[model samples]
Target chain A: MDRKKNISMAVIKRLPKYHRYLMELLKNDVDRISSKELSEKIGFTASQIRQDLNCFGDFGQQGYGYNVKELYNQISAILGLQKDYNYVIIGAGNLGQALANYTRFDKLGFNLKGIFDANPKLVGIRIRDIEIADIDEMENFLKSNPVDIGMLCVPQTSAQKVCDILVNGGVKGIWNFAPIDLTAPEDVIIENVHLSESLLTLVYLLNEGK
Target chain B: MDRKKNISMAVIKRLPKYHRYLMELLKNDVDRISSKELSEKIGFTASQIRQDLNCFGDFGQQGYGYNVKELYNQISAILGLQKDYNYVIIGAGNLGQALANYTRFDKLGFNLKGIFDANPKLVGIRIRDIEIADIDEMENFLKSNPVDIGMLCVPQTSAQKVCDILVNGGVKGIWNFAPIDLTAPEDVIIENVHLSESLLTLVYLLNEGK
Candidate 1:
């Protein structure tokens, strides 16, 4: 945790990429991995991987590289993937439903406790057997069934209001899909998933002939 | 184009964010903005904003700051948003449908040319007036109605195959939503949108008590 505070956000962002690669390696039954090998697979440079991992601790030996399974576990722990986290979707729109039905979350230990929406037409609909509750019921639902995270998929107009509801309802973190930038109290963590940003980045890259 | 080739990927990634903030300012009828003002609003440092903008050319005057509309247009051109690019979604699942129905793309000059699905039942279903075509017809469709980009929303198992088809069909860029690392030819730009990576980052922040 002390090491985490000292790490840069750039490095923190790459940890999950490392985790994903390590998971793939584990699935392939590879017990060992060199920085170069991992780098070739993930696109990040070998030196950058070493530097990022060193911020956490000396997980890799000088010559032995890294134990794939052990490193995977360590990275997972550092990423807070060891603990089971419950989350709820704030909007039952297309984005919200896609996220609710995203099968990977459950495999990653994130339990979808509920799915809520402001639209009367959407409320009560089941996405993967999880019923979409009314936005008005979010507070009560959160109180009775606490969740660590809230996935905000509401439109930009209603994002802040829905975010506020989640925060007040005791959600410690928010994964926002709305285009709007949101603000929250110091205690609440917010990670904005700007889909368009990725698309624009691709556009720039393509235009550059990369 | 020469300046773009020299710019770092990190800087390129933030271009869309700067564009977004500038758009917001424009919408509010704000005509002029300073790096300091933008920094405060967007969370990047004033110096960083200046540095980023300087990569393309001098857009900000020493004392006069920047013309909001002009700067926005400059950034948009740099992001290739100035040109109209047609894109086809290769998987008409929930994510694909959401992206196809995403109204913001058309505003950004990315026209939804088509949507395709391997599922026979899903094929021909209309999303936002654009019919979902059978994946088998993708090659034929791309031949007749060529698109600049292919948005891959298929499962991990089929991502690579779908991507190959897109490339063979002459698509220049790929915005992949599948949780797989896809490979493409040198001319084809690929941007993998790993949704779980963002979630894990949120989890890490939450557990760190941020």
Candidate 2:
């Protein structure tokens, strides 16, 4: 199984969708899928699917198409889902609690190690058996129990501060839900889910006719 | 203002980010910004910023640069933020509740008129004065209280069914939080925030070196 280097971010972003569709196919006991059939289910063009899958490796035969389980497993491996990732939520606000309770991430091998918030009232509260700890303990917690990812769900004002703590504590990936963008070092990866910008974009598209 | 038609989706997506940064600038009491300075702050190339802003109308002078407030207001108008958008959450689970509690959306004129849920316990619960009603009441609710956007936070199984109801009830836009890709009419815009896919992308990037 030879792999290709320098896969484009566009293709990397689409790999999860491919993984998801393939998983659905496997759930329904589908054995194999032609690129055309996969395209119809996944909404990408057949040629685009072929090109994207080819970026990782040669998965499909000319006429035989792709093996469902084989493709799913390969994409999963490509997505780094084969190993479990432990992460701690920095701010246990509504968004933080929502993410903590989102069971799908856990199923995808992402574990919620701890949750922290500055609010005194929220301290000691539990979400899915993980206790919400004091914000001051976060750096110490990270030093003792290192994590691969840091889920930043704090307010924009404090987001960068908490992010600095996370990065300084040696976390590599940040799944940020704050509306503001944070500056980070070269080695650390930051993925932002800017909900306001998303809502604004939706509104823009809704009124694009105007 | 001479507004251009058929702005590319790439430009549309970037408009929100520009709006965000300009808002920050206004909050900081910055009155003007040159394209080069704006580019450094916003992480886009100066030429790219000039091109994107030009898609709407002439706002900047060659050396005088852009009036921050003027540009911000223009982009807000372009994003349709000047008008209030009424929306309802289709499923008041963890994510739905979080959206309901999000004050930023309210500040941006996206009003939460209603929240619907299938769970009997959640049906009568209130988040910020808006009560969660039975999911069965959504169609009737939509008939009387028309909404601009339908936020789908339901499970994938019920997403399409609820989406169909929202569309049939006359929603023009959908902010879907459900993992599945929903099918809507050409006129009905759907913006999906697929958390699992986003998380997978982060994990994949984190493991890109492996």
Candidate 3:
């Protein structure tokens, strides 16, 4: 694989969309697809799709287009979906429990190692067959368990503190459900799934249509 | 407000981010901000921020920059946050319950009118003070209550069917949490918050860093 040193964030963001579309096609037994066909289905222009895919390596041929299975496999590898990543949810609240029970995580190779919370009443409770660990044991647990990602489902006030603990514990990635913005070192990657922000976007679009 | 006839989706996507940052500034008692200062905090370029803001209307002054409170209010109105939108959750699962209890929705102007489920066992249960209604009564509930948005937290198989009900019952927007890509008429808007896709993006980023 010819890895590009500096790929644009825009291209990186669109990769998952492309991967998802390809997965759907593969499920439908689509053996091959042209850029034009992909563009029609995925909403991105053919030229833009070609440029985005070319960032990694040439996966498409001129007349032959792309092999759906091979392309899907390549994208899966590129997305690191081929590897099983161990993750711990910092808060065993409603959102955290939802994520813990989310079946897709196992399908996508994200293994939920544990769920943790500060409340003693909630700790030791079982969610999706995993016992909620006490928050005090988080750092110790990280030392023993190889957790690649930390899912922050705590409140705004505790999010940053939890983030610091996660980073200090050698967690490389954070998927923050907290509303607040967290600052992390350059080495750590953070992706925020702000539910409110997404809802606001929908509201704006709905109003705009009117 | 001078609303542009054609606003790019990219620009529309950034509006919520700007609103979030401005809200933070307001909370911190920051009265004013320049485009450069806003860019530094929001990660968007100064020119890009200016261009995005300009799409709706000129909200900034030459040297005085912008009044944080005023800009925030303007953005709130532009994003339809000023109007209270009634929303109902289709599935009374963990994700749906989380959204119903999400405090930010009330703060932002999305009112949780009801939560519904097909399970007779789960129906009539109260989540966030809203009693879960039976899925059979969904059409009747929509008819009686003016619900602007339908939050789809159902499984992949039932997502499209629920979406159809929401649209046919006169819901304007559908905030889909289901993994499937749903199809709606041109008049109705749908925004998908695919959790697996988000996790895949994080995994890809974590791998890329290595």
Candidate 4:
């Protein structure tokens, strides 16, 4: 069964954690895992895991555990990481360059296609076998390379403009590092990745004795 | 009344957007706004605004709406952001540098104390008035600076090591950009600012036609 939208947003949020832990099982050559063992590994309750897994339908029988590989594939497919996407970076600044060098993104099926920058001076700069191109070249570049995801590393001042360009260029989605929010067409998705905000929330939590 | 735990998390989540919209209101010089008007401006339902705001107790007068300045102050205080926190960015890499230049953080009462890096070549370098200190000097620097919040922009492999050091030096909260899942003492709060994961989930939503 397809993952249900009716499922709680909290359940959707934890799918990545479940996927990560499942990948560990795959790595260890484990063939199957009981919900109890999985919960122990991930520090989650077993009943929550069974309920979460059941939302997508029965992956295991009553007395048996789930097939590690099969469950991993299902969660991976649900997360859209089963297939690698051509991931390009827009605006080759410190943020973009840092993301380009970030090795973990590649492990989860994000392939660095190229980098684009609005600055003339940065054009043609090479980072990890990816050349930084002029922002104006984004349209033509995507037309040829067919990038599915574009990481917007542009400035807050230029975030909306750059996102518009990417959206018009047919980018399916964006990973925006800009501090500002960009409203896009319903067809195009934008995820605002603000690190400091998350940290501040953690500080708020620590102060609250959480 | 001190904001409760539930109010703290919920308020902190809304603060960034509220702050952004408040700045927009300030720019437009829109003074008085009712719950309905505020909801329309931010695309939140009136009931959601009322519920979210009411969790911290009634801030708006009946029918007369909320005073812009007064509501903003209430939100800031509820977010524990009325008092400025000395914030430091550990790992002066691409993400670190981008965060160093994030003006919004400071506008929301976060002071960028310094950027810490282990690379000898990067040591003593300055990014937007935040000096780059060697990670070796982390304990000494943190003791002297006494920052309440730290934003981690280090590599995933270095996450645990950095957290160990930071916690040892009295850093109580961390905003981790690295992909690694870190285990910290209960006293030390750690929040994973996983950008790509959030983006990939959005891609999953689009592919699923959500």
Top candidate by TM-score = 2
Model 1: native contacts recovered, as a fraction: 0.84
- On lDDT, the stronger of 1 and 3 is 1
Model 3, runs deviating above 4 Å: none
Off by over 4 Å in 1: A60-65
Please provide, for model 2 over A8-76, each residue's C-alpha lDDT reduced to its tens digit, 9 standing for 90 to 100: 888988999998899889999999999999999999999999999988888989999999999999899
* TM value for model 4: 0.90
TM-score against truth, every candidate: 0.95, 0.97, 0.94, 0.90
Give lDDT tens digits, candidate 4, residues B1-210: 544654645555776577567667776888878989888778778888888778777788998988888787776665567687887888887778888887767777778877889889889887886678888888888778787777888877788898888888788878888766788888877888776568657666656633
Among all candidates shown, the one with the greatest lDDT? 2
For residues B51-121, write the lDDT of model 1, one tens digit per residue.
99989988989988899999999999889887899999988878888898888988998889888999999
Error of 4 at B41 (Å): 2.7
Q: Rate the local accuracy (lDDT) of all candidates.
A: 0.89, 0.91, 0.89, 0.78
Q: Give the worst 10-residue stretch by lDDT in candidate 2 chain B.
A: B1-10
Of candidate 3 chain A, the 10-residue stretch with the lowest lDDT total is: A1-10
Q: Each model's DockQ? A: 0.76, 0.77, 0.71, 0.54
Name the DockQ score for candidate 3: 0.71
True contacts kept of 3: 0.76
Candidate 1 residue-wise lDDT at B106: 85
lDDT of 3 by residue, A43-147 (tens): 999999898889889889998899999999998988888879999999988888899998878877888998999999999999988999999899999888889
lDDT-wise, the better of 3 and 4 is 3
